[model samples]
Target: MPNPIRDVAPTVADAVANERERQESTLGMIASENHVSEAVLAAQGTALTNKYAEGYPGARYYGGCEFVDEVERLAVERATDLWGADHVNVQPHSGTQANMGVYFAALEPGETILSLDLTHGGHLSHGHHVNFSGQLYDVTQYEVDPETGYIDYDELAALAHDVEPELIVSGSSAYPREFDWERVGEIADEVGAHQLADIAHITGLVAAGVHSSPVDHATFVTGSTHKTIRAGRGGIIMCDAEYADDVDSAVFPGSQGGPLMHNVAGKAVGFTEATTPAFEAYAEQSVANATVLADVLRDRGLSLVSGGTDKHLVLVDLRDSHPDLTGDDAEAALAAVDIVVNKNTVPGETRSPFVTSGIRIGTPALTTRGFGADELETVAHHIADVLDDPDDEDVRNRVREDVQRLCETHPIYD
Candidate 1:
């Protein structure tokens, strides 16, 4: 390659270099984000992106897709081995699109959908009013128990019985506890509704057997191939063999056009990695790091949603400890110290989602950078130090030194 883009478009090249510097220097604690391996990056940057594979393997609407078919088939086969699903579709552009594929395959417009509320750790694709899911369907929502910070299965069952929804969604973007998929399946059965579990944040954990698999419980399981799995930027859908043709048709002719074969190649590479022992260790460490983070923050007098975490992320509700502080305040303050995290809405939030009352932190990226419990504990102290006194310049300066040292010690992609 001549690299004319860098020669002619120096400004864009500089921005790309800056972004690489930013990721290499700062701590990436976003729950929905992860750094892909260099191999995955290489696969995603290939010439496969130029192809137009508009249909499933061996049956494409476009020509010259033989290699792309191999990539797609490899992705689906590895995905089946990873999740134990009967069928897998690797073409959805994102997790939201994957959910749409399932909904289109099974439900008609105006059918009722019951899902967890967004403020309680649910995703926007799960029928948020602003998304197409909400606009086209009659959506009802469930909430976590205020007293115990857990899903009330009894309440959910009662509500499902009351509404008789066509589909019931179970999964959360920020939920720190493992879901009881069997119980959710039981509730769906009682209401005569289909079960769709969106495991966008826990795809790797589930693949590694650290979290429960919804493949056996839900009628349809959808997830992002990125996030914890580090499979470039795309989505996947898994279902029974009975719905395979319908799901595939809905994904191609019903919703999207030519597939992103470059991303599919990345998914194939990542899924192959998932079948290894090292990936299992990574998943286990991710959860352990989150546990340490929650404990360290709580010891510093901060309140954690659900009181603690059983997953790879923690939601810190600052309302009880720092009533004057909002999630936005904590996020911006931490970012200034090079400790990246996101503002999030807590259950029964009294503030707007924009400001929020909580910060959601995760360990996948940190773990990928070779972080362990001790390192994460130190990172937690830095976060607590900044949140404890967001206005103090000395505190921020001191935390900045510590963060830079840690980033140097565990330099990513170096």
Candidate 2:
């Protein structure tokens, strides 16, 4: 098939073609990314992109919103069913915007927000100094135990009492273990604070019942549609009926203008796909693959945060094994071999965020491409080999061959 974009814009068509080729050739181990199905890709490219749906279904500020309203309604309904929420908003452009909706609805500006620290497996939107959450709120951070690489509930409780925050955020971007959501809810109750659980990375796991949910414990839940969910790029917010009006208003007028109807249609298609038993099996395999990857890395003498993972990603702290190596060097070495992974900061990190001592590898995209335990084990060894001697061109060449073979064996997107 001739490329349509090639006829109109050759430069953009070249970049798009190159990017698609990159995804097809490389192993995407980045935890925050996954490849959506062709159905979702088609939905996002539809003519619905031309519409402007500014309000919720059945009530819109613009004309000719009936069809776009149906798209948004399907997205909201499927999300509500998947997560079992009293209300769902599928309007926010991204996860950060979804979180902003909750904050705008629940707290006044300059009010307190207690959350996890960024370097300690927490997200920037979780009140880091550089994000809007930190700029507008009195943010206090809690950390994982330096020795065990786990959340210190005792310290968190003490901090909650000391700060008297109006809102408490749960969920993380990098921590390897499952959170004790019930205990965090207890602390929030004791301190009279509302809990916002950001399950951006684990939405698919949570939906598949592979991971415990925060829906019952948190006052609000926010997640990205693109990550583990394999959906179009967007965000979702869920809350009780009482907060539904506030969340809707916050997302619409407070945070953004018209909703992206095309993305919403894509989300609807992905959510429908997620309801199938096959997707549940995929979610389970993703966790199993991560576990196998962690085991292989550990057997090769690398240190994993929390000792291992209970979710879809593993954070490797390289300071103990490769004393001189940095995450940047490892990422580059692996990228050279067509293995894509991101440098990440670990708990008690001494290096700057740009050049951290850790790397976070995930299994979602690989799992989607049909990689199983045996394949992951082989990939893990290749990773360890490169990291063990990144300067060796011979090692890089050998691993590059194996990676290419693997990509050929499990081709994506037909």
Candidate 3:
């Protein structure tokens, strides 16, 4: 394999080398991250990146887009078919931009948008203060049930009715349970609000029919290509065909300048691959592995948010299990032993987001590498052991050896 270096600067080459080393050496357990296929990587590095197709297919502002147009058109068609979408916009550079396009197309500036609170699992683009979504729009926040650690639909509906928001954003970054989109849709309709499902993490599950589809109920749906989709980095927006022109214009001129045709082609490839029976089996296994992992952790006396999981991710509340170990400390300790995960705020986090009370782990990437319930159980055991003795070097060393052995059997993209 050729390195993404030599022709690049030494600093850039060193960064690439470090990234490759990190991926090769460590276990990637981060819920929002994954390893892309070689085919997708190759497509990303193709010559299409050299061209700037400023507009949509067949209506470009610039010429010499014949091949690029075909790639983008194929991406649009495949994405629409993949998600059963009436219309698809393959132009958004990331999930954040996809969301931006939706807002730009549907809502006026400073209109009220009801979204889950950031510390409680909502994304930054969903209306965190630092983000443009918060600065440009009037945001109303919602929270998970203090007892259940899940979005209480009854409470959410009452909030929606009270705020009468112009848009209601649904999705989560750390939530473990399945969403009730139908009820959410009903609440949105009652308030005359637009419902947008930011299913960035569960797009693969939805694609394989393993999770609930939001396209049927939501006015717009958005997702990242890299996460569960096992594709390259990009974003897609799905909506009804009647809004196709509005979405297309919003993406092309309102949000991003030029579409990445190479990424679009890779997305097309991913969409095609996601249609296979193997992909369905893989998606199903992803959920099963997560369920098994969650059970193992809970059995070890670790408190899990939402009690358990219905998808690939689990949120482990470390405060009750290890009172002294902050989420940041636990995350660093685990990384030293080759187990990777992110620190996340739980339902009622006592600490700030920077030093959260919980850690988020997911099995989709590992499951994609052929790991099943047995391996995940063992992995969970080692993780628990590491947490139980975070200061013991010998214990960490032993866990490191176990992790290496486990990862060897299920080499990603081998």
Clashes of each: 0, 0, 0
lDDT per residue (tens digit) for residues 149-202 in model 1? 899999999999999999999999988999889999999998899899999999
What digit string (tens of lDDT, one per residue) describes model 2 on residues 1-414? 988899999999999989999999999999999999999999999999999888888888899998988888898888888999999999989999999999999999999999999899999999998999999999999999999999999999999999999999999999889988888889999999999999999999999999999999999999999999998899999998899999999998999999999999999999999999999999999999999999999999999998999999999999999989999989999999999999999888999989999999999999999999999999999999999999899999999999999999998889
TM-score of 3: 0.97
User: Candidate 1, overall lDDT?
Assistant: 0.94
- Candidate 2: clashing pairs of residues: none
lDDT of each: 0.94, 0.94, 0.89
Q: Any runs in candidate 2 off by more than 4 Å, and if so which? A: none
Give the candidates in order of TM-score, highest first: 2, 1, 3
lDDT of 3 by residue, 5-59 (tens): 6566778988887887677667889998888778888888899989999998899
Pairs with steric clashes in candidate 3? none
Off by over 4 Å in 1: 1-3
User: Each candidate's TM vs. the true structure?
Assistant: 0.99, 0.99, 0.97
Worst 10 residues of 3 by lDDT: 1-10
- Deviation from native of the Cα of residue 258 in model 3, angstroms: 0.2
